[model samples]
Target: MSVWDELVGQEPVVQTLQRAVEDAASMTHAWLFTGPPGSGRSNAALSFAAALQCEEGGCGHCRSCTTARAGSHPDITVIRTDGLSIGTDVAREYVRKAALRPALGRRQVLVVEDADRLTDQAANALLKAVEEPSAYTVWMLCAPAMEDVIVTIRSRCRPVLLRTPSAEAIAGLLVERDGVEPELAGAMAAASQGHIGRARGLARDPQARERRRRILALPAGLGTLGDCLAAAQSIHEEAGERSAAIADAADERELDDLKQSWGVEERGRRPTGYAGSLSSLEKDQKRRRTRLTRDAIDGVLLDLLSFCRDVVVAQQAPRAALVNADVAESVRSAAGVWTVESTVARIDAIVEARESLTANAAPLLVLERMMMEFLPR
Candidate 1:
């Protein structure tokens, strides 16, 4: 029932954080938490923050625990990014607030999720606060890895690295915590490659399961160059659709909220500054959509690469657990026809796709080129 219990399959991380909480020596003015997506980096930060703030060192049912978990704690402030990057204005605000006194809790804890998304000015703004530590302030920054944060900032913070959880651990968590069926939970956990968020999505959403199944089945259908091209196109189109769906959902909610605030309907809009707000909102939406597309394509590429890796491992190292165990027959066949070198090339293709996306290349164009490279001669 501890707050740390919410972090799935991360026993080592939990133990480390708990020990840090118990002993005052681990308490630092700044901490850097790094892990893969869905690895609970921010969650760990918050739970640890809760433990630090709690009078009894993370008594799970205490008021501090509830407040920290719900993100309404008086002294715990979490900055989350909904846009492409965090600007200096926002960072300055947080820094200014951080400089102030604590309202309720003993230590004023600040958690910044997506520290990698902080713009240069924003990073500098926050760096000042990091450099000058307050006696009663604690800062925890979460990112994909230490490399994502500026070396100056990273150097000032204690590092906490979280490894990807094992599939067996994830499945056990789903069964024990989520009351999921053991068999279905195991499959979802394996397919998700220990990404807790993805495993939960696959467990709860039938559509997500279908999409994963489609991705995993790609190897069996790659008989001809045309098949490869088609598969590539399928991956590209599906990624686009999924990304757009996410953007649309958020965009719609934002628009609805704006309309309500302005008291304007679609057919009747007569506010003084409505048009300007609408323009700004659309611009923000566009950036978010672009980021979402790239993120979705990146995820698709990862899934594709995992399948290839699983196939490679199956052929050369059958004892290893396969990421796509449910589709083992196709993985075996694909590995059977391809050499380790060819499998390595396919993995390279995935790396290229990831590079293109990270470099701001067009998703469709990059995926199309990758597909060409992945096609068999």
Candidate 2:
């Protein structure tokens, strides 16, 4: 297996990067990888980074390939933010870091996995570094699409686009790598609608599958204003609770690690700098929690969109396969209750909810409004 093996269904992308590796003339200081969520654009960027660092062009068994993929290579840095945005402060710091020479590898590689989240200021801060990197420095940025990246930043980088993986491709990966049953893998792949990450989650996590089922069932039960309102609240609160649970667990672990480092306990004497360090970590954790909460809500919105789209497919193209095939009865019921126009409107409403949530609207209010939009037409 090569470093590119994990990039399922991206043969064209793999070919481009491999040729670049063989021909230095095809390589550049900066590259932008664009695709939809779960298209593995980030994975492509990372594999490309490993290939660049690998002496034999990314033989998966090489130390260079292994360390780079595991994020342990001294010369490679991955900027991944779980928060809402990659702020100017962090971007500037990384720009300075990237200016340094490689210590132990062929090049100094920096991969920004969520370049689309860069604030305008952050993008501007990165522009000069990307435009004129040090010799052997490479910048690979991944985003959902070219438009998601700022024009100035994107214009300076080579564009590598990844197509959404087909269900057949995703199912094949699940069977090959994850050891999932072929039948179950196909079902999850179709349900995830080309989202490899979601497909994995659906196949591995019973909770994820259950949550999807609940989201798909919303349409048939949302018959009244009260029902819609309640659904909105239910989804909002559930997402919040789920995010909080994850954050709490992570925070607890960090807190323990910090205390161990400082040699202090909750009831013991505080170290000289422990209080300030704790405060800083708490602030950072708060940002992460906010981002996670938004992410959870966004996921629910996507599932709802998929269900509505399935209903539309049932109405207009009766022979087309539905994403939520396991919930065919729910999809058929929704198709019967709503006209094609109404289903399209519901889809539009879900899109609006996504946009509103991104704009920092109150989650409960946005979900409530979106749920009411699904009320009987």
Query: Number of the top candidate by TM-score?
Result: 2
Error of 2 at 15 (Å): 1.1
Q: Tell me each candidate's TM-score.
A: 0.89, 0.90
Tens digits of lDDT, candidate 1, 1-377: 88888787677788888888888786678999998888889889999999988988888899998988888998999998768988888899999889878888888889999999999889998998998878988899999999999988999999998888888888888888788999889988988886888888888789888887787676666667677777777777776787787888999999999899999987984699998889988988888888877787787788889988997898789999888778788888888887888888888988988997888887777876777666564
Angstrom error of the Cα, residue 192, model 1: value is: 2.0
Q: Which ranges in model 2 have alpha carbons more than 4 Å from their true place?
A: 252-284
Give the Cα-based TM-score of candidate 1 against the true structure. Answer: 0.89
Clash pairs for candidate 1: none
RMSD of each: 2.8, 2.7
lDDT to native, each model: 0.85, 0.90
Model 2 TM-score, 2 decimals: 0.90
